[model samples]
Target: MLVALALLGVVCLALGGFSVRLLLEQRRQAALIAQQATQGAALELRLKELGKRLESYQRINVRMGEELGELRKQVANLPERLARLEQRDPASLSFSQAARLAGMGASAADLTQACGLSQAEADLVARLHRGRPQD
Candidate 1:
């Protein structure tokens, strides 16, 4: 009976040691799990913020694309608009006026100042369009 009691005490001591080790391990594992959960939550928040920023960038890019398309359309119409403006400009009629004045015996200086012709342009028109001298 004394031997049996000693054996039982040894077994109980072993089991107590094992239970303490298991409890400490469980606590350590729980702490690690809690740390991992915190990290995961932080990462999730960062990802959501990045997604929102990406959406904002996409919206800005779309607006810029629309503005670029409008600019392209305006650029495309510039040449035709310039042509119309040139047609309506009074300077376009200067050469015809110079020639008519030349034909009516106007002097080179008169065409140059009156019709905005350069000296060379006035002299050429005077020579080309002047009337013949009366015989």
Candidate 2:
């Protein structure tokens, strides 16, 4: 009876040790799980920030594309606009030049020679601008 009782006490001690080991392992696993949860939250926040940055970059890319397209359209129209300017009336150009020369206090003969204006047109411009102060 004494041996049996001693054996029973030894078995109880072993079981108590095993239970303590199991409890320690459980605590360790819980700590690891908590750490993983924290890491996951941080990763999710970072992902959201990256997503916002990507969206901003995409918007900027779209705006730049639109601006580039507008510039291309303007560039394409340049030749036609230049053609119109080249085709403007010779008389109109002469008249404009005559008016500018007359405004500078040029004589009628000077207007006629320099701006290809008719004598009558040169006289008219000279008369019209005679009152303005000279630069």
Candidate 3:
């Protein structure tokens, strides 16, 4: 009976030692799980902030695209607007140059060649500026 009691004591000690080691390992694992959860929560928050920033950037890009579209429309109309302005001023650069040449006694043909004036415009310049008639 005393021998049996001694063997039982040895087994009990072995089990106690194993249980202590297991408890310590479980505690370590619990601490690691807690740290990882904290990191995950922080990463989630950062991801949400980045998503908000992305949304703001998208809004800004949308506004810029709208403005660019308006600018494109204005640019497309620029040529027609410029044509109307030039039509309003018949005495443009060529006409002025033709008139100066006519005042300097240049013939209608000379005004046409030197100033790129149309034949009718050259004749008008000659008549208005008292230039000599074509021979």
Candidate 4:
């Protein structure tokens, strides 16, 4: 009977040790799971922040595209305006007509303003007129 009691005590002690070990392992597993949950929450927050920034950039790009389109339209009209202005003849009016329109008696400044000619162009026109022999 003494031997049987000693064997029973040893079995009980082994079971107690195993139970303590299992409890410690369960606590360790719970700590690991909590850490993983925190890490997942942080990753989710970062992803949300990245998504917001991407949306803001997309809006800015759209606004810039609209501005660029308007600029292109304005640029397209420039060539037509330039072409029309180039078609005008600056020397169509005779010196007498230019003098009359300028309200001066054939003066160089008056002719320049009347015919929309620069000073150099008016001087050239005057020289050409003088070179012509009077009929």
Clashes of each: 0, 0, 0, 0
**Model 4, residue 6: displacement in angstroms?**
3.2
Which sequence of candidate numbers ranks them by lDDT, best first?
A: 1, 2, 3, 4
Worst 10 residues of 2 by lDDT: 78-87
Expressed as tens digits, the lDDT of each residue in 1-135 for candidate 1 is 999999999999999999999999999999999999999999999999999999999999999999999989966765464344335655544766666787789999998899876787677667656894422
Each model's TM-score?
A: 0.57, 0.58, 0.62, 0.57
Any residue pairs clashing in model 2, and if so which? Answer: none
lDDT of 4: 0.69
Each prediction's whole-model lDDT (CA)? 0.79, 0.79, 0.78, 0.69
Write down the RMSD of all candidates, one decimal each: 15.5, 12.9, 13.7, 14.6
Residue 114 lDDT in candidate 2 = 91
Q: Per-residue lDDT for 39-98 in model 2, tens only?
A: 999999999999999999999999999999998986676546434533577655465566
What is candidate 1's CA lDDT for residue 2?
98
What lDDT score is found at residue 11 in candidate 1? 99
1-135 in candidate 4: lDDT tens per residue?
Answer: 999999999999999999999999999999999999999999999999999999999999999999999989976765464344335563664544543443333556766776776675565445444434443
Candidate 3, run of 10 with poorest lDDT: 77-86
Candidate 1 collision pairs: none
